[model samples]
Target: MRVVVGTCGFQRGRRIHYRLLDAVEVQQTFYDPPPKSQLESWRREAPENFEFTVKAWMLVTHGYNLRLWRRLKREVVGDRSAYGGFKLTRENLWAWSVTLESASALKARIIVVQTPATFRASEDNSERVVEFFNNVERGGFTIAWEPRGTWWNNRDLLEETARKAGLIIAGDVLRERLPPRGQEIVYARLHGLGGAEVNYRYKYTDSDLEMLASIICGGGWREAYVMFNNIHSFDDALRFKQRLGGWCGS
Candidate 1:
């Protein structure tokens, strides 16, 4: 198995990034998709071996009313709650459409959909997820979901939904979880964790990297992407590659 590792965002210059990382989970997509010209510019600067994955816009996941329009940089004046969410609504599709444009510009392969902590695991939400995934025009793109909150407690629902939709259930490995179901690829995010949840200030230890390395090695997965999502992400990603005895590289 091959492990493609990198930080959540570019912590260094494109030239330096080309030397240290093989992939990046672009965080800007969640807030606003960069202009196509900018995406193309980054793509041009990156090496052919480098890969990018993007976080989908919050409009498709979070239910924050007008806050959604601000994040998407659009003018949609209405009852904020009526705009977007996990629902298979017109607004959600529009948001995804915008996100896809950026992904195409950057030649990104994976697009992550991360719901906020308030998104519960009710049957209605599960059904909404299925409807959205089934109807969306994916254009050969892979959608990985990192649903926070109560989802962490319901493996059965997540596995079933992901399998049926051909979606991958992304895991935050620092929370001691792996992809709910094995697919051709595995995607993991490591946000420095405290005993309970993400501790953005935390740094990884050598032993922690070893534990993650074991998971990335293989378990019916052909490829694994391990991305760091914390203050020390760049250094943590580098040390993880080192711990793997140089098995990882750009």
Candidate 2:
């Protein structure tokens, strides 16, 4: 398994803790805006064998101009007042691509677009999802789609489309929304084994780690990127990495 660890922020500098990781997930600017220089410096300090995966900006998932209350209204009451002024089109995707490409010099492995839970799966929504992937494909980057809903109800169709387009399925142990197995390349964001989840931390048991390790070992993904969202400090992630390394005999 080719594991990638995630960090809340990478702006401080890469020399901080990236040496302990095979890849680092940049999550700080996913909501606010892009900071090219900070990301670039991370790439410079990262090990030669290291890879980086960045979370797509929130504008891509949450609608750039739509306000929080407006989005809630739309989801709860199906209101269009919030969307009336915003131009949600393919063009905006290019802006995200540009931001992603800013770190191209670092040879990023995958650009993760984690759709909010509000975006449900339906025939119409799936078409829009396909269109989004098509637009992003135009730019030279590999995309990993992580939809929160049970979007893979049509796994055959969704997986076929994803395979044809060369997009990777972002798998998660906690969600199980997507197929549990099978994909050319797999990208997973492991939040934890699941239990009493706090705001940012999760307590993963030994059995949970073993189970995930089994799936990873069984699938034989060309490369697997695992980002630990349970990070309160680096200790948990470091311990998990060590545990996973032992499992893999790395």
Each prediction's TM-score versus the true structure: 0.91, 0.76
* Each prediction's whole-model lDDT (CA): 0.79, 0.58
Q: What is the C-alpha RMSD of each candidate to the true structure, in Å?
A: 2.6, 5.6
Tens-place lDDT digits, model 1, residues 125-240 = 88888888899989789999888888878888878878877799887865767785447788898878785557778899887887777667745688888889888888899888
Compared with the true structure, the alpha-carbon lDDT of candidate 1 equals 0.79
lDDT of 2 by residue, 145-244 (tens): 7766556566766676566556677757545543435565667676554453223566566666666766665676766666666554355556666788
Candidate 1 at residue 208, lDDT? 82
Question: Candidate 1: misplaced stretches above 4 Å?
Answer: 65-79, 246-250
The Cα RMSD in angstroms, rounded to one decimal, for candidate 1 relative to the true structure is 2.6
Worst 10 residues of 2 by lDDT: 77-86
